[model samples]
Target: MIHGSVVHDPTGSWDTKAPLDRDAHTALATAVLHWDQHTAPAPAPADVEQTALLLSGYLDRLARELHAALETLPHGQLPVRDHVAAEIALSQVRRWLDGPSGAFQGEPLAQAQSAARLVDTLHHAVDRTLGAHPPTAT
Candidate 1:
């Protein structure tokens, strides 16, 4: 379902273009923030199928957006490690999407929580690459 490989064109988009546009970056940031803030509550047995469907769709959309963010990376702007992490996150989401029953260990909310966490990870990486804010000292 989810592949682990990360592919990039060395002389491609980022190499020839400016950094991600402010508007695009902001939109991605907003999406990340929204997903981060919205946590899925546990679903009842009857609604499990519907909840799984919604989460699967959300994961699909988020994966596309993450790919877009990756394409917008300016050369040398973000470390290669960040990009790899984003790819891995996307793959994790994909695995859930491609699952036979779309269940994460037999729990719908658990699956959604997993996907949301992956999205959060990608969002943080993209935000860092875009210089949205300084990483807070822990």
Candidate 2:
């Protein structure tokens, strides 16, 4: 069910600061690398629904993987904040997934778009977390 690349800051927690601070060189780099808006023409309702379902599943799986990694990574290699960040980030993604995802509430398209962006952000965020501090080679 997973698809696409290019993550973004759907939760806005990536930078862990104000919008202007993102450009500040002194700011600690966030898990987010980069992101872009969806530019394609509006999709059909069916397409949107399918996309949402697929992304929701993918995001859920990715979050679980990240959560497990955060919990299991060898000690002395992780800062407490690393686990904290993973908790907060995954919580935000899960909250969104739990919403509207059940019944495709209010605006189906909007829900779908939200899922798309969340998935994108998570993709990069998870990558940043593991990539920056990869497990030691065996």
Candidate achieving the largest lDDT? 2
Point out where model 1 deviates above 4 Å. 1-43, 100-105, 129-138
lDDT for 134 (candidate 2): 61
| Model 1 lDDT-worst window of ten | 28-37
- Local accuracy of candidate 2 as per-residue lDDT tens digits, 1-138: 998877685864553332322122111112111111265545567766776676666566667667766666666556666656667778878788676546367565676666666665666566656765665799
* Per-residue C-alpha lDDT of model 1 across residues 1-138, encoded as one tens digit per residue: 987766585643432333324355344334433443236433464454454455455456556666766777666666777767777777777776677764456654455556545545655655655562335599
Off by over 4 Å in 2: 1-41, 79-82, 100-103, 132-134
Error of 1 at 18 (Å): 24
Score candidate 1 by lDDT: 0.55
Clashing pairs in 1: none
lDDT (Cα atoms) of all candidates against the true structure:
0.55, 0.58
